[model samples]
Target: MPPAQTTAAPPSPAARALPAARRSLAPDLARGVMLLVIAAAHAHLFALMATGTDATLFGTWDRIATGTMTLFADLRGYPMFAALFGYGMAQIHRRRSEQGREWPWTRKLLRRRGLWMIAFGAVHVALLFFGDILAVYGLLALVFVGALRLSDRALLGSAAAALLAASAFVFTITFAAGGVPQLPEKPQGLLGELALRLSMWPFMIILMTAATLFPFLIGIWAARRRLLERPEQHLPLLRRTAPAGIAVAVLGAIPQALIKTGVWTDVSAAVGAGAATLHQITGFAGGLGYAALIGLVAVRIAGRPGPIATALAALGQRSLTFYLLQSVAWAVLFASYGLDLRVSTAAGVAIGAAVWLVTVVLAELMRRADMRGPAERALRRLTYGTTAAHGRAD
Candidate 1:
């Protein structure tokens, strides 16, 4: 006899949290690549801490490696991450609303997530890496979501205001300091270190948010336009933006690159500040340009989803987990308390790339196994309670 007709169970909220069938490839792809870029960007900080100056830290491959990083990776990754974070935040809100979650509920969920993020970031910085963006993002998520309710014109205007104000503030400070000033302090003990890191966090977040405001704003704007979500629909815009944004970013970043590579080591403080101010101001364009370029790549890979892209996208999907992993790796390899490994400019980059590559493999494996990264799973469970995660379905 035919078995009693049975029904399939619905997808769990946990499963639903995974990208739906209609999930945009562009964002994931962009995020995956962004991690690598971020990894590269972060390596310099470790190197900087080890040797004091980012310009002098390189052992042998000084000019070429640092120069390459300056030209391509430095000051480029954070903006992309910021913009993408804003975009993802918008997506989260939109998805919840579409799923019939009320504003109050959605807002509460975001705040909870933001709180957890701040907690995680604090812990991360205390234990592992100081150059953590998680906390900054957590803070941003809490503060920036309010702007989502604004009208399009208001939102854009606010973003512009934020960017301009941030630039002006930083520019004035840079001008006062004479150029990209360095902040280095020696902590007496682990406790001192912890306090110092926490103390430094707020200022860093505020300053960083301002510098990267354009990306966050554009991310929100792009999300509203569904640009990344519907890449096919925005090809023209992406195509035009990809090159233009990149050009602006590169030109703007050149001064920093020159300084970083010691090409003009003796520039006056004012000149140095001027170069830094240019770099910071132009970084917005760089961040947006990078996103546009990634979108264009996604468009080209429309029919053919290659293994590399697939791996990158998987890495992107579990980016938070891998991002944390990067910090762990840095702690293990670079921190004074850890191995305290020091190497040439090229080697630091290689190490960072290697860590990121390891994550790509791990993430891809998890993707294939239909499992989430441990951090991701924890965050998801925290973000949406176990019952909701298990019972609710999209």
Candidate 2:
């Protein structure tokens, strides 16, 4: 059991808002890069309105773009995010518990944070991106708050079981139903698009929540182990898992790459569904691999991470703000209220990459000025209360 310090009151929220002097760079760095992958993945999904990546009309470069996105970006980015979510949650829980905050109060704080996330997500989905994950994560945090208390064995077992079951469920659904659910059509009018977004909320929320649970659980497990937080201590383990996870994830994703690239476009429905399932099943590796690789990088730079690393880490530090901004860029480029333009897959990916670069520069500016993201500041205040939310600009 953790030693208790209930005698002393917890630190003021304002003071707590300050950055950790010895913060782990791995998580922030990983998240910093992860957003790019996410942006690219999401951009491709929007591009789907134009045509399938594998469509015969696509030029060689387009096909190559689709294949690259398929193998490296799609079905791959979410795992890292999910794992990080769990990792961060564990950190929060542990910090409070160690500080002598009773479980009841801490859990309440977490649930409240989750509630705010849901609200943010609703607004985000309604106005900007249909692929928002904030609300799903918010709901997951609330639903799984109690799971943090579970023993390591229980957590790992549950994660494994969920992984298998979720994969099977997705596979079965695709296999039986022919493909995934149909998305709501893009509306040319701003109001119409908002309405369509709100309409699709129920289905998309359900899908995102269920699909991401496995990684969330794994994240919790990793946090308990302090995997990312203490990379130096876990180097041996990281070295082993990093390569293995990538290999599995890459290999498993091959079938998906083939289908998405149109190389195996003519396969039977059932066969195609199986390929999709294979991608889902193996995606765990991708998520785990990303975290591990980042962990290794963090270790290497434990002493000194130069300007580039510092900038990336800053972006990761304020990931929520950047994440939302990514959609805003997408909207201007693709939504009716904005450019209302559609491009080939390759072009879209390039656009996504360029937009992400913009954020990197923005993040560096924030870092240089020592400012926190506006969204993060608001969230901190909301979660902890006005006085408690007091923080430096950075």
Candidate 3:
């Protein structure tokens, strides 16, 4: 008699989510560092809101912080995230394809994830913060998931068009208005605040989409080449991008920074608008350059990352959790019903850095314990199923 035979079960869809050891260090590291830049930028904006003046002009340290942030951090942070988001999208698609999943099914999965993210953004705005980017990226995913199937030339062409359109829109608006738009007044009560946030959310989504779409497309292009994933294979390109992109970003930022810091207060509207247009365009380079530079760092520390590198990578792996945590901190610290601390730009920056450091430590602890960030876990469950979500990385 022949012995009975049984077939092994197939791997779950969620199993395709990159495991910790197998995940690329560069993308995660860039994300962790980008959070710091985001924190500084937001902190500066909040400080400016409170002061009702350009916070950069407050003091020597404030001037230094603001200029540094504007040059390297301000518009830089979100674009990096946008590119990374595109990269992640491609990653998911690639994994699904390798698993023998068809394009239509994968497309549905991506859309489902995007819808959940939009829900998450709504909750975030209602309870914690107003400047929620999750929804913006969510909408991007919902709209552009098809781009994953696009040819490289098509992707690049679309990105270029989007970039030009965004640049033209910014230039036209600024030129017409003679300056950037002013921040809205902070509403009084919790209900009023919620209303204001919700009201502003749609407008923000539109603006952020325009600003982020180009990089998001560019990210898809990079992912197709496995740029970040296989940094060693593309050393020459990364090397060239790092310095050239940063240099362009810095030069483009100088005029805008000077104006904001009051050094060029008497400049005409045309000059101010032109400076803004240049900043907007160059910011894309800055963001990509930062990512490229981080990729080089990852190559140098490839096999054995030190303690700090390990911690930062951990935070990056669980970025959604830490990012939301930062929002909660901001709300508690500055909400009208909360402490409402209106510190200087320098102080705000210091506080933001401190908050980011605390997250780093917390993320390191979570890494040791082999715990997924609560938000990441939830998102995965929503995206895949309970079985697949059990042990997944973002």
TM-score of each: 0.90, 0.95, 0.95
Model 1: how far residue 26 lies from native, Å: 0.8
In candidate 1, how many Å is residue 322 off?
A: 0.5
Between candidates 1 and 3, name the one with more favorable TM-score. Answer: 3
lDDT of 3 by residue, 213-255 (tens): 9999999999988999999999999999999988989999999
Error of 1 at 316 (Å): 0.2
Which parts of model 3 are misplaced by more than 4 Å? 1-10
lDDT of each: 0.77, 0.82, 0.86
Candidate 3 lDDT (Cα, whole model)?
0.86
Sort the candidates on lDDT, descending order. 3, 2, 1
After TM-score superposition, the amount by which residue 251's alpha carbon in candidate 3 deviates from its true location, in angstroms, is: 0.8
lDDT of 1 by residue, 249-286 (tens): 88888888888777778877778777877887777787
Off by over 4 Å in 1: 1-21, 53-60, 183-196, 388-394
Clashing pairs in 2: 370-394, 371-393, 371-394, 372-393, 372-394
Q: Is candidate 1 or candidate 2 better by lDDT?
A: 2
Q: Cα-based RMSD of the predictions, in order?
A: 5.6, 2.1, 3.9
- Residue pairs in collision within model 3: none
The candidate that wins on lDDT is 3
Please identify which of the two predictions, 2 or 3, would achieve the higher lDDT against the true structure: 3
Q: Per-residue alpha-carbon lDDT of model 2 for 258-354, expressed as tens digits?
A: 7766677577668777888888868878878888999999999887999988889999998999999998888888887888777888888888888
